[model samples]
Target: MPTPNPAALEFLLTRRSRPWRTLCLPAPDRDALHPLLTAAARTPDHGKLEPWRFIVLERPALDAMAQMVADRGGVTGVEPEKLSKSQAEYATSPLAVVVVAAPKPSEKIPQMEQHYSAGAVCLALLNAALAAGWGANWLSGWPSRDPEITAWLGLSETESIAGIIHIGTESAIPPDRPRPDLGKLTTWFTP
Candidate 1:
């Protein structure tokens, strides 16, 4: 018989993402992040296609990204008023992981499957953070889609940034927002 983990299940049911703005310092160190990466690797991938890769944004990389974002923001037509605020997100975050979707073309595996795998990895990483007692959020900023920015992050031609998972201590607990009504959304198949 498979061992059931009720605690994990219950936690998943009640879990909430700590708002990115409310996340602060005390992020995971290299030794501490291994398990989280391992958990994220367990995400569902059709055809065994490992369609995602992670760019662990340590201090230096984060700083570079922050500056690059600010510069790129200027070129991308981001309003002058919001540019600094946008760059500050990277500079201030304790830790950030860029989930890149590298969709290798395959005759057997469809592109959609690769995209799905990438998305699953993001959720898995988020869950790992929550389970690890850290506040986390999955985000994809404007810089994610920029070719020049992606090149700096070492993405192949086919790869794109799927999400930027930020993990840190919670500065404030956000109120529970309303959720979509599942009863009204789901279709009954009993008939």
Candidate 2:
């Protein structure tokens, strides 16, 4: 029989992302965040090729980034609503972690696998934050994908943002959203 961790399983089953807009102040400090990052770093890494990194964005940086997005919005022709949403995400966020998918060169491992590892890191970080009683949400928008913004983030030519995870205190508990239908989404295969 397989030994199971009931608490962990329960947490996984019930985990829900707190909306970014609903997140407030009292964000985790560097010391507090150290463990969360450590937990994230423990994500499965094939071949020990660590293909990701974290970039913590505190309030000041987020505010500046928000302004940068606004400044570039008009010139870049970003739609008004989209621009506003993106700006608000940064401006109001207490803290954020940018999971940069920096894939290291590997002879056996494929580049796509490295990208997947980065994505896994993002989820692990998000979950770690939530498990630590902090409200967390994984987000990405036009700003994340914009070359200029990515450049501002100091990403290299090959690096990309797997996710931008917002972490802070929750103003209010968000209602649980509908989950996907497991029967429809899953497939049972047999030879």
Candidate number with greatest TM-score:
2
lDDT of 2 by residue, 25-118 (tens): 9999999999999999998899899999989999999999999899888789999999999899999999999999999998998999999999
Ten residues in sequence with the least summed lDDT for candidate 1: 80-89
Candidate 2, lDDT over the whole model:
0.94
Q: After superposition, how far is residue 38 of candidate 2 from its true place, in Å?
A: 0.2
Worst window of 10 by summed lDDT in candidate 2:
140-149
Give the alpha carbon lDDT tens digit for every residue of 132-175 in model 1.
99999998867888888999999989889889999999999889
Give the top-scoring candidate (lDDT). Answer: 2
lDDT of each: 0.90, 0.94
Backbone clash total, candidate 2: 0
State the displacement of the C-alpha of residue 33, model 1, in Å, after optimal TM-score superposition. Answer: 0.4
